[model samples]
Target: MTDGASRRLLTTRRSVLCGGLGTVAASAIGMPMGAPAVHAAGRVVKISMQRSSVLFTVLKVRGTLAERLAPLGFEPSWHLFTSVIEPMNAGAVDIHADVADAVPIFTQSAGAPLTFYARERGAPSAEAIIVPADSPIRTVADLRGRTVGVSRGSGSHYVLAAALKRSGLSFADIKPAYLQAPEGAAAFEKGSIDAWSIWDPFLAFAEAKRPVRTVADGTGLTSYHRYYLVNDRFVAEHPEVVSAVYEALSEAGRWVKANPEAAVALLAPVWGDLPPAVVAAANARRSYTVEPVERAQLGEQQDIADVFLEAKLIPRRIDATDVKIFRPSTVKG
Candidate 1:
């Protein structure tokens, strides 16, 4: 079916199942009958995501978001995009999940009115600087003057920068080939780039298909924490919906951790029918634990902003914690 038509169908299904509940909820919350329902009755929560986001992939595949949000009165709509920060900055989506921490720094610098609601713990090993198994590049230091492929503004981008610095080198020490993960992988396979810095399941996919060695993972470099964000206006107008989404995602994270095998089975097709083993490997490296966004947790983000500023990647320096953050009272049990 066409994308628009499919979304309409999902909305219809959600309204039919939860319409009455939303009205009751609205009344309970002291909202007038003429006012918008607590569940957002006719509103659809457009979630912006990418295929690489395993938690979102699982939630989308299971189709549980609709049921979970039915009482809250919001219909879930999924929008696939290449980059989370771009679409969010353009006002294309109300919410975005699985965006790397570095992306917000750039988006904020660009004046996008975005705010953090939730974050996943650091999964340093999930991203890495990879090289062909037999390549002469044996260390991050060896990358000097060599071409390294990385997706600009991604978590891996920061990982690469930090890796270089840790090696007593800087971005100017090497030539950077800015490419998306898929293109970077193809380029790496074609021997056009000396190394490909990327995150899973692409990392897992490449490792499964070919022999590659990790020069360095994010271990001592970056936190690799993914953030869940929403437009500033959305949070101001519909804080409950934002809360519901954070709770739903937090629950999904728990489910994935508890049932790794099932998560792999469900995510395999969404991830292009990837081998269950590869999916499992990728999932294993990820924390899959969601938590509320905290200022203390943003130290690395500040560091990322500084790094990008130093490299002139972002237009200006930004205070990572200057943006809004929604902290709901109750954590999901």
Candidate 2:
């Protein structure tokens, strides 16, 4: 993609901008008719969200983010994606709702011009290595020689890798089936795969409907933070949009935690009409506390990058603290 083309892609449009990725584009939330035009002139700010990002999805569905951006003359254009890493890296989107810690590491290694603005604090229990309920894989060690399904470069992938190392095994000990969530779930159900490394709400969904057992979670393996990011170009051009997004995300997360029932009711339908109970269960495992990303907090990210590098999963080594960070106004230096 040319520099001009990439810039154009980052700038939003009334119509679907980038297609062919199975992305479901939601209608652009236009500025209110009487709203004051502040900085930009009703420019659309493209943001991508996955169902796993509970707070982001809630904010999108409830129009909280749209409301926040409207007064600033920025229309919020929401897009549904199973993973936002690629689109953000390609500069196809302006803001990434949230992606796993490992994702940014891989993106950084690829030299994607991305900046971390906010993060959902560590929720170590949200992701795990799940096995058949009756399977004899009693421990992480038992996973050796087993077929394990994982989303390549996901936080859960790092969990599986870390778990294996803790148990005196390496990533090569098992046959890895790199599958997305749907494929992994189906393969796990068919008994074609011995185990799956997955995260909520998929983790909650699997446990609710399938006979599965969690062998190990990220308790001591990984912090499993979810990061909110934006393309570097977007950050440079519209720092106000970035701040609006950060504040909205932080508020949305607080709302979800404070009003669990109402939040579950709102998110259940968005998550393909999942049961409220399941939604609540998934939400419980996640820490919806959004905070600014600081250099000191990047220790684990560097560790994740090193691990992926040692395993040859990422193309090159990355210094996790090398990227830019947008400090929200609420957070003082």
Candidate 3:
């Protein structure tokens, strides 16, 4: 989008309270997540969610988070975000439901006061580099000099870069058309771009509805974890609330994995009215196991940071492990 389009969308971002579960608005927001039961009436904890985050979307739609927090002395205010980096930096949101692992590296480079709270396990097959069914591109190397659509600073960004490297190529080999999923889908369909680096359910939607072939997925290139982040100030101010939210999110992940059919039914409408089968296909590629963020798990994060830096995507080098990790009171230090 152009600067004007972004500004307009940002101004029109959707925000809701607990009761407005199924509401869809002009645009979305994304941010990170805790606190205790003090029943502080109007104390609203602002949250941001990306549309692709199915488990978090389900949690929001269930409307049970408000009930869970009311006793802890707070109410819930939810915002749907396309990206949480700007919102978190501007303090527009307290908690970001989930974002691809690569996103935080970019946010960190920009010096956002964010902390990692939780993450979904690696699901390598969740994202991929796709081509038109009859395109001449057969391998990652064939992408050389071709135009590839990708979201800047997204997990798929790293996936494409890594896959290219493994094929003895570099990110500069291709012309990157930095487009968000919706625009990327349109461009791909119109043959304006040679290939697209994207994640599910968008990936699923394309496969189920369009003539595209998966050239490469993250299988050997990336693990594709989705991270939950919170503003550092928010974590310090509401420790108990963070703890409650972590617990609730962890349980939501378990429930989604345990009940696939119900998950599809609940997510289909919110995901732009995609068929239940498409939603199911997308969910199948996700590892919705939410757990506390640990330093050991961030090795890939450092790799991602280094890759983006080497590719000139980020301005400077960063130690991805430098950010704060939010550990609930129940978790050991």
Candidate 4:
């Protein structure tokens, strides 16, 4: 969007939030600039996503990040891909934002150097088992022997498999209908599949448009969620950039929590064509926590890695500790 358009939408968003919409106003205001001001003295970087919210957050400067990055010549350029693993595997993007649980699968399956950096707190059960509103799949175990939709090798796919295991079932117990996000959503609408496992915006979009009901999400059935990941070698060389990105994301998390209503308003334009209530609901469920990587977190990732390895989800096991890089003190403005 042009600077004028972006700012106008931003202003309108603030108004929407302030009108007792319940979301806090965007407090990180900066003098709006006209054009991309990222001609700084650093290497230009490309961030990747599979149509997830973090990708939107990065490019739109959707939250606290806009202010924190205002100082750095760090303008964002978005790169879209089918899955977080593919882009990082190809080494096409320098920074990759993904679910923390997914790190073990790609990094260990392939020698991908992406490491867990920051996390999106309050992870919504967005990526849940969605059955057609009229479907007979009322319980998790009901998913057995049914064809479920998921993207092969994506985080949602992994989570769905993990969810199934909790019911004492495995991939062998059900039919996994492999399809991309859009295709999967469409298939679910047609009742061509028993259920669809997916993440938001798409999850919200599907739920609103189809006779679907959420059967599982990021909760008791599934606790592992996504985390911001940076290229290992890239972060080692450009720690400052890594730090800047983290600080910005941390701030964005704060802003999202503080001003959810405004955040949803700003999100509306991005998702204008979609259902507003879905956006509002999904936004409220998103976990936007900002904390430095801790050993406990690494241990959690390691636990995921072990599960994926046991399931042979990834090609091999990954030593998560070797890649859980963080420098929170330096990631500040």
Candidate 5:
């Protein structure tokens, strides 16, 4: 049994960023997103995040998982968030559930020092820059000096950083409003924000339901990916647990891919008036594959860090590899 002290160590150390292993790797093989073991007997695991589609498992499935995992003493805790990263730094949540783009910045950001753990094995999480259908912000370049809303370090934040750079603009080129996804979506609808930098299904939701324009996506920015992360201490003390968590995520990713409409239906109740049209559009693009973080992707992230350094989005440069902790073979089914 991992004592309280040991758990705390995991909280601080094995965190996600160096390719966050699912907001950080959870465990087991072919078991499907951290489904509680058939026999619950071990430790109590707490997963926290905003009730968003991306952080799907922790928010939606962890409770049922707790039941199945009872034999392993696996318990479940679901924490809510308007912003994903806050839970990690405060040490209030075991996993800093968020999009992959946020991973690099979370690890390399000047304020925090951490050992990143796990990440989703898939294409980058979805994102886009949205304007009202009636608005004149037709392209990325047109967004210059306009109020662009996004949750900093979230996928949209990264997308905006790269998109702005690609369009011959800097972060200074737009009016940055740091708001949560839901808030940003509402602000976008009310015309409170000129444009929204956000990821699906929010992007799809806004476009289809709110009549917004999508000027870009993750592929557009190339660095806006989804991720799973854990503190470094968790990785060292509970490698088995981490692997188990990853296995479950792999299954969930597969499930999501296979049943896009089901996934959307599952999410709509939580999204608060989000349009199924948007969810459907977003679902067509999500990928579900569990693999190691690839090099090109890392390069994109590195580029983001460098650009941020030049633009002062972040205070300093950080080597993306400095805090990686992944070992797939160590997973226990």
Candidate 6:
């Protein structure tokens, strides 16, 4: 059979299977219909977004994805999650945008059926390890034996590891407080942690709200390429929807790059009315261009996986290319 016919057959089989599953779940729950029944025709595509994700936030705020998908007979559902891997593993979302490269590596290592559909160019300076302006921690070396706040398994974790390795230090040299971004921000303000390693908007917000110095950033250390991922089943069942999302995001990325002021204006409300200057600063450090995921572009991911394995952050080593990659034009049907 041709690839297009094969995909259609697979989709049909999946739809029937999902319908049965929905009936079974509803019966078990003593309900007439279940969650999957709500999407009997699979018209709704759930998108999980992180607050700090610039391109996704821009797309969400402007309702561009909905506008793009409407004509394609798809509805876009937006949901917020603290991190990308959580909703994906829980089966709560179909597509998740702006996950850090390290996140997928860890998720893949955990044996989740996740696949990459798109990627952003590296924004090395988009994340940083910062200290209060009046603090005595003057250098990366000074971090040794000090408490450092970082969200464990996050992009910032990889950045901290790389930065420390470049400075001839290791994870064992400092006390790691595995706090979320908001918690880390609070800790940083209270002087409970010596420094906080974090990404943009949070980094930008901190800098704008107080005096902080960049002890080091991802530059010369890690690539900081964010990725968009979807459930493996979603790709097999809805390639066209995936393609539409990719095109919509790519277009939004371009729009943000060309219209910084408008981008800031649209995003400020979602960010709790962050100063336009802060948002602009965060946007400046990011590379908003989106492209297809390719094995050739994943060398940094291998390094990141190795770092996590060495640090015992992940259970095992992972081949970064082992997961599926959805190429946009390859959707024959």
**TM-score for each of the candidates:** 0.86, 0.87, 0.87, 0.79, 0.78, 0.85
**Model 2 C-alpha lDDT per residue in residues 141-260, reported as the tens digit of each score:** 999899999988789989988888889988889999988765676677779999999998878877887688899999988899999888888888888888888888888888999999
lDDT of each residue in 1-333, candidate 1, tens digit only: 567766654553343213111111111112111111234365687777665666776666676677777777777776655556667778777887578777888788889888889888889999999999999999999999999999888999999988887789999999999886666767877889999899987788878878999999999788889998898888888888888777778889999999989998887655555678988999999998989988877888899988888888897778887878889655643
lDDT by residue for model 3 over 180-284, one digit each (tens)?
766677777778999999998778877877778899999987889999889999999998888888888888888998999999988765565667888899889
- The C-alpha local distance difference test score for the whole of candidate 4 amounts to 0.63
Choose 3 or 6, whichever is better by lDDT. 3
Ranking by lDDT: 3, 2, 1, 6, 4, 5
lDDT by residue for model 5 (1-333), tens: 247655543442243211111122221111122222233456666665543435344225434345444555565555545555555565555555544655457655744434444455444446677788888889999998899898776666777888888889987788999986666766776788898887765666666655666777667456445566666666667666666666666667777777777777765534443456666676676665554444445666676677667777677777764556565444443
| Candidate 6 structure quality by residue, lDDT tens digits, 95-202 | 875787678877887777877889998898889999999989999999999999998778999999888888999999999998877667778877899999999878
Best of the candidates, TM-score: 3
Q: Which candidate comes out best when scored by lDDT? A: 3
Rank the candidate models, highest TM-score first. Answer: 3, 2, 1, 6, 4, 5
Decide which is better by TM-score, 3 or 6. Answer: 3
Q: Lowest-lDDT window of 10 residues in candidate 6?
A: 20-29
Cα RMSD, each candidate: 9.7, 7.7, 6.7, 7.6, 9.2, 11.3
Poorly placed runs, candidate 4 (over 4 Å): 1-42, 55-74, 122-124, 330-333
Give the Å shift of residue 39 in candidate 3: 13
Q: How many clashing residue pairs are found in candidate 4? A: 11
Q: lDDT value for candidate 5?
A: 0.59
C-alpha displacement of 112 in model 6, angstroms?
1.0
Q: Model 6, residue 132: what's the lDDT?
A: 95
Task: Tell me which of candidates 1 and 5 scores higher on TM-score.
Answer: 1
Superior by TM-score: candidate 5 or candidate 6? 6
Give the TM-score (vs. native) of candidate 4: 0.79
In order, the Cα lDDT scores of the candidates are 0.77, 0.78, 0.79, 0.63, 0.59, 0.77
Worst 10 residues of 4 by lDDT: 24-33
